[model samples]
Target: MTVYRRGLRFLRARRRAVAALAAWSVVEAGQTFLVGYALARALDEGFLAGRARTGLGWLGVGALAVVVGAYGTRRVYGCVAALVEPLRDQLVRHVVARGVREGDGGALSGLTQQVEIARDTFAGLVMVSRSFLFTAAGALIGLCSLDPLLLLVVAPPLAAGVALFALTLRPLARRQEAFLVADEEIAAHLGGICPALRDITAAGAEALVTADAGARIGVELRAARSLARRGVLRVACLAVGGQLPLVLLLATAPGLLAHGVTPGALVGALAYVTQSLLPALQNLVHGLGTSGSRLEVVLRRLTPDPPPAAAGPAVTRQAAGPTAGGPARPAAQPRPLGVPVCADHPPARGPALSVSALTFAYGPGAVPVIENLDLRVPRGAHLAVVGPSGIGKSTLVALVAGLLEPTSGTIRVLGQPVRGRAAHGRTARGGSARIQPVRGPTACGQRVLIPQEAYVVTGTLAENLGQLRPRPVPEAELRAAAEAVGLGRLMERLGGPAAEVDPRALSAGERQLIALTRAYLSYAPLALLDEATCHLDPEAEERAERAFAARPGGTLVVVAHRISSARRAARVLVLDGRRALLGDHDELVERSPLYRELTGSWSRADSKPALAPRDPDRVDPVAGPGLAGDRRHVVAHGPVGQMQAARDLGDGGTRGREG
Candidate 1:
């Protein structure tokens, strides 16, 4: 259902309170008319007459009824206000949930602001409308009963005033909307400044950012002024218009009384019309001017054509088809523990990744970040991707991490298609597999990403690390992870593993170490290090690279900007623009011009071609082999020699490294 329809439903559900309030307004309007009529009658009859007593009783009764009506209105408004709090709360929850689900924080924030304005402003507007109609109807009926001719006096001016308001309100609303948009931009700009402050100051660009923000605020102020001017003009017209009829009545009432109209009737009708026009016009102005504009903003924001829902029964039915290269079958209904995953049975205990022709674009109109990308990392192998900045290197890493979907083609985690939704659940192939849909450690329970900046929140080190799971990781495990990456000494200097190191005091490298430690704590089958080493020094990089190399089973896809990092990888993939190719570090250095340019590999003089490792097994069947490189030994085999051959290869320094 449309949001406006839903909102209307909500207001309608509170019909009991609305009815009570409307009833109170009717009583109040009736009392206003009665009081005016009583006063006019009393004045005309003269106070010493018995008619004065009758009029005084009505005046007192009218006063009492007004008090009761005010009290009832306040009570009903309170109930309505209470009802709306929960509605605002619901909108907040929807926004939060949408942000977490779709990663659309900006849109969610806008939606939340719109819903709040609607709730707060709409209630006042609806109430005011109720009061306005009550007063206008009561006044018109009383004036008609006294003398229908007065309707002619009020209607023409009231219509003119309404037309004037409507004509001016369009520009007022447009200006108001523009001001609000600018104000929101200013707020977002200020919010973003904290992250960019260091960069801005370092680049001497603080003035530029400040100037930009000031310009936006200046525009907002101008628009606000324009809106205020229009509002003033509208109010001026409404005020003059309301009083015109009253003035006309005063001049005409005495003449009508002279033409055999009772003085009591003329005065009573005039007073009633005066009382009604004053409050009714005022409330109508408020409703149309301020509240009306705010409500329109709310309605516009809340009534966006909602995107099609991504989850539910219909999606499940669609999932029963050839997806991820599997035959069609009914999707299971059981929700996964985390992000939902659906695919074939993953190969038992294989390397954590495979990608073939993985193409992805951020949006429909944007250029494909990674086009026809092919990458594979063997089980327990470390591979680094290096390229120039903006060469889609980060995009490639994100794909391997499974944080983003390929626009076309396929990605497989351990031989299972990592397409559609990835998590552990039923697949179109009618089998269950563990696929982590969302990016993080929980998916497949063995994947982790150490993002570049390594965010640190305001909390104890333990608490930040503890964000990985509900429970705190043991100190021993934390230390082990830290020690694996050369953070042991730092941890020791900072009062050991239980140390409550304030993140603010730590150097960038130190914070990065903590981030790495968090990643290390996850025994994921795959790890994507996206510039994870950027903040580290050479020594720390060496240590971290070694630690990553030592990790077994999981595939390591590293996006590195440094040649030092490329040298440590079993293989290096050079991405130039949207293209990628695989080769050993030196092979890529020699072959790929982009790689040579990036690493300054051409600078080396008289660098000899590195020799490929040799297998001596084919050389001789019986004879024992001689040593080759450092700490090398070789042996050859036979029936008794077979035993010797096993010992020889094991003792030899020929442990293979595959690229």
Candidate 2:
């Protein structure tokens, strides 16, 4: 309905072009009328009456009408261009406006694909709609001039077929819309799952993931089948409208001849039926059937949603308590110190981390990877999350870090709600201005998350360390954090904190140390480390973990990489595909078989040849552990970056270490 109203409004605005197009179309209609009328005159007054020259002249007149119709069609193309180009431009503007105002992710798809579809469909609909209306008019009028009986024979079937086709339009449009939505949803589902396929297999969720993907694909299949069913009805309309008229006209021919119809008149009527009426009716049925409903659907999709009736461009959506006739809205009150308004309030009595009935999956219609999960960690508590590789340990860390939103349930940090990635200052919404990242001095800046692979930008070492702080970090604080996380050697070697940094030149372990130091310097009350120290030697990993756990009034959640890491935590959470188990390391070692197996594997790994941590202040700057010594480093599915275990020495270049 919106598309229909929009179409009428567009036509009204371009009345001059529409008028010019109609005038030319009338010339085409005259050509159609003359085509059959000239033949009838030729046979009745010239050829059949023994006047051959007059008959040839009548044929020539019909030929001349075709040339005039060609000129009219050329003019019609210009008028159609006038209408179509503006509509396309208007659609492009509407799509961009919606993308900017509403943050619609599908705007690119609309512009690149659907906008062009709408333009082409609208042009075709315009050409077919006008051509059918005037062509039908001319052919029908010519029929009446020939004989009333011929019109009677042809009119009923044509009217009946057009009505039948019209009946199919609404249902066809619904099917088209359904199919498009289903296709997009399935595409998104597949894109999401592809990156997680290895993880899904590791967790033994192959069957569940497969079932979820199948369900999404099934929806698309059903929609396509429904669309095809409507296509069958369109074919039925074609049979009734275009083909049935011929059969009826022939069956009623004998009666027309006996009822005072001449031979030349009979031939003329046949010409009108076969040449004029049939072709026009066929074009109308096929062209309108395919394009008319399609144009409507595209127009509806491209139209922007209407703005609120009472609101204006000047309205400030931030004022919560303002009324229509009340005093002017006041400015936002300043936040108390240590409070990042969009982040948690750090209530004294509440748990630092709270997750209740949380659920998540890779995509829409995907089975929940973390389903109905609940967790809570009190202030100053150290919790270790231990699980097999790819068992959603990182996912839990991401959810707590506000990088991912749970599908269902709540996540509250220090008594404040974090709205996923949007909570981290960048591109997030607040009152009138953009939201800022949560930060504080004692509570651990709102919270810090260090993932497995560290990210270091090209900047001074001091800049990288202070990246998370809301304000500039002091020189003393930077040096203290660097020494605390075992980055003193790297910092001094790279010419102190002021020296330029290239992330690619740093080893994986060195990068991890820098990220740890950055976290150490943040004001977050809680720290989430998702295997953040995995690349480090055991001793260096221990130092980093100990530094975070010792923070003032801070809570720590570490996705553990080794069995020894679990021993330091006050509590351990073990996640397997079937359920979640929680207890202290010693208690779990005694009672849980899975925990024992994991500890046993880690204990075995510890006895194997592993990298020994070098004392930063004592070790030779140019000489350090190389890939030649750490045999157990390749314990997992692939190589574990032994090249980053220490600096690359000349003789130890790319050695194929332990089997």
Candidate 3:
């Protein structure tokens, strides 16, 4: 659906509140006319008839009713606005949640602007406009009821005034739309520049960036001036268009009175004409001026309503091949491929992870990022995924973490499917991330993935560390996480992260360390470190690695580019062209060419020959939990035996390369 249609849906959702506000608006308008007429009549007839006190009392009663109506209307207005807040928040949350998976931009900012505009204009100014309309309608109806002939004199000019105002303001509306778009561009430009101004200075490109900003501003200024001109011309047209006919009416009023129109009727007709024409003309001008931009923004923000929720694989079947048949049977749900089974539920303990036939692509047609990728990470294992850049190493981590869905595969963390990204194959920006955040009661507090980039929110360091509100982590625990990542000294060097005062005050490394602390706080059974220590020094990186290794019960999946990190891994999976070459630190180093080239030493333990498999049914004591339980399993088949078996499957085979 288009944004405009979605906006209408939003309005429809809050119809009751809107209706309440609209009802009061009409009541206020009618009362306003009544009070005006009553006062006018009291002065003209009662005072002129020498009954001043009675006339005054009649005016007071009319004034009192108007006061009460307006007061009640204002109260109702507040209630309507309050009711609309949740609707606005819901719209924003939808956009934010979608953005996490889809990486779509502009929706969040536009939603904020639209809701604020609605609160300021639609929720408030609309009441006034509606009041004006109803008030004018009542006065015009009363005037016509008193004397139908008077319409002939007032109707033509008022219609002309409205028509003329509309004609002149059409251009203004188009210009305003263009101007508003340019204004948004300028805001985005400034926002981009503000945070990274130091880089421009360091690079000596300040003049170039400043010139770019100036050019954009110049464009905005020109459009803004054009809008101003249109506004002025519209106001001028309203003045002349409204006044010319009113002047004629006033000039003819006395003559009309003498020509058999009663003076009281003439007076009332003139009052109605003035009241009816002026506000209508003003509203026509204002509507053309304001509504277009507000609406354009509102329409841009609202996404199409989602299709109805479907059950399990049925949903995917409907999405994948709708014409194929009746509802497709749900795919056999696999157990976890990694630990920290639940993000919300506190885990009994972290567990090691394993995957088989883990294959996934972006879509049906694209080549898979991971293809039949298989790995066995023992319980409490600290393994690193080392590959040349762009080798799908990080993507593998994402898949294992359940952040991406496999095209054909199974991942078992402590013998359960990953609860995060993998199960549904969703990215953060597509609005699916929130669902993955809490998968099931048995799945909570199972695993945490530390992304490559660091994020710091606008609050205290404590706030940034624990995304969950009411901050479950204590100061001591937070300090320990900081120290474990070797950021404790950095914190002290910077005078304490808790008192660091601002995220801006820290460097990129410090920010990344803080993010590490956040992941550590999650205490998941499996921690997938996707370049999580990319920012730390060698000593600090080792310190962070130890922290991951020491985490209770969870297996550690580390994706690293640095050879130092690879050497530290108990087992390293070398990926090249989306295929996995798995072996221990020493075994892979000697046999795999890619390992040697990356580490630059054939004799290094990281470059050892791939290990030959041992006999079937001979379990290593260190392997823990064997092939049967929640722990990762090395199949009883010898290394060479399993390797041949995997090759015979006719899927991609694991091959060690000579550098």
Candidate 4:
């Protein structure tokens, strides 16, 4: 009731616009009246009187009335805009203010997606309601003027249909709300667990996870079935409101004519019901049923609740020791193994990459896949982001690269805030860290992102490598970069850097080599690799990554596909969808469960895990495909190498450290 009252007040505030809209609508009602009345007058006084020219003149009047009504319809749309924009702006201000005050994370979703839905649905609902109201008025009046009996035949069914639709409104809205909430819960639950499939598979919890996810899915299925049952009312409304009147008029026709109704009056009354009333009522049932309920739900969520009568005591998680007058500190949380990244630890030069309270989601009702995420990467640091597939590792890189915007919070690559718009922001200028926003393969020209499925152009290899650079790269620098990143062989095979590269002819690994060389030769200080080298062999990938990390005063962030990549990084970020765990490899092994499972999975897959289980006392160094481990020695299971060279790249990543 309160939400409704507030809506009435909003409409009342814009009464002048309402008046202008109604005035135009009245012209439309006049059009409806003329359509029926002109037909009847032409039949009785002209055609039946043998005056064909008079009958044709009356038909011309009805045609002219249609033109006037179209003009009025055009004006109605302008009036609708006058009402809708103000409502949208008002909701935006209120939602923003409340979100800031309450720290409600959903505020961004309301602003971007929900508020837009409200605006469109409100416009549709208004147009249908107004059209039905005035159209019913004009149509009923025309019926009564034709004959009193016509009104009696039509009124009962139309009223019954409207009443039935009105009865479904409250229940239908409740069903909609329930189904939406159920859907959200399912999305949120699946979002957390789906990305951790590697962990789940390694832990042997597949059956349990499936059953739990299935239960949530079943809840949504039931809700949808309930919503569909209610939709049957729409068909019933159409039958009674639009179809039943014709049946009744046809049945009562002979009796009505004997009661003194003229033939022309009968035909005009039928036109009024079918043309004006039936079409208007059908639209009203559909538009109001769907859009009206949606608008109500959206508006209620956007509106602020009344203040509580009294303030409640503040809730806090307290440590054992606290002074009587001082505020309580939060209880100790599980910090990662070394150099805790759970809290901000900026160096004197500030972090090279900083993300504060960053959040993102696919839709308004879907879960926030990344929420309140905070981290800082020091300048020139080698950081690896390791997670199971679909854990939003790529999305995180996209946000940092400024290819996509965060739902809330901020991302700064180097020192400049990342804005995902190329039209407004300029590329980086002046100092290296001073980057501007840009929407391209690179962000502000300070950071370069090498995505999976590398892109190759029809031009020469030199042109492809130099595309990221504003000035053409010298032939010597390009060749040096290619040789360093292990692309020297591919370059030689394809003739030379000057040769035109055919993308179709090149293998997937060859394309990745080209992209890697391109990123290495560019001036961007930060390199983001989102599984960019997946197509390459493990050794080739290692060489490329090391070359990029070894770039002077450069930082590297890799979305790792293997444990070797994670181990090579100085620091690692583990995203399990629920929370972020940041630490070094050995530290994460101790503190993070998801990272432990993921590392196990990647280690086995990356390494040729062809080891035979040996007794704890015996060091089975011979069965190891890549390593010769003694009792006191630990070999880091690393990137694949050939024969004797491979033995040094250990696979025995167990409960001990390397000597």
lDDT values, one for every candidate: 0.60, 0.72, 0.59, 0.73
- Work out the TM-score per prediction: 0.46, 0.57, 0.42, 0.52
Question: Comparing candidate 1 with candidate 4, which one achieves the higher lDDT?
Answer: 4
TM-score of 4: 0.52
Q: Write the per-residue lDDT of candidate 1 for residues 498-555, one digit (tens) a residue.
A: 4576756775557667777666555455667876665565567778777766765546
Candidate with better TM-score, 1 vs 4: 4
Model 3, TM vs. native: 0.42
Compose the digit string of candidate 4's lDDT tens values, residues 1-659: 47789888999999999999999999878889889888877888779889999988988888998999999999999999999999999999999998999998899999999999999998998899999999988888888888889899998999999999899988988887878878888888887776556434322245656887899889889988998999899889888987899888888899989999877778888888889989999899889877776777778888857667657786676446776999777644422111101112122245679999999887788788789999899888999997754567878887787766688998887677778544112322111111112224332256677766466656788877766555566666777788888988888888777899887677556777888777776656778887677656668888988887877677899988667888999999998874898999999999998888776655553342233223243222222122112211212222111012233445533342211
> What range of 10 consecutive residues in model 1 has the weakest lDDT sum?
427-436
Order the numbered candidates by lDDT, best leading: 4, 2, 1, 3
Question: Candidate 1, 570: how far from true, in Å?
Answer: 32
The better candidate by lDDT, 1 or 3, is: 1
Clashes of 3: 54
Error of 2 at 531 (Å): 8.3
For 6-91, candidate 3 gives per-residue lDDT tens digits of: 55787788787767776666666566555546655766677767888878886787778678777867766675665557656776
Residue 362 in candidate 1, Cα distance off native in Å: 48
**Cand. 2 TM to true fold:** 0.57
Among all candidates shown, the one with the greatest lDDT: 4
Cα lDDT tens digits, model 2, 1-659, are 37678789999999999999999999978888888888888998899999999999999998998999999999999999999999999999999988998899989999999999999988988888898889888888988898778788878888888899888877887887788778878888778667556434322235556787798889889989998998898778767876787887678778888997767777777777688767776777777766776777677778854755775557665545677787877744422122122243334557888888888887899767688888888988999998765567777777776767778889887776767755543211110110122244322336777765466666798877766656666566677777767888899999988899997688767887888887776666677887677767668888888878887677889988677679999999998753788999889999888788778767754432243323332222111111112422232213221221233342454633211
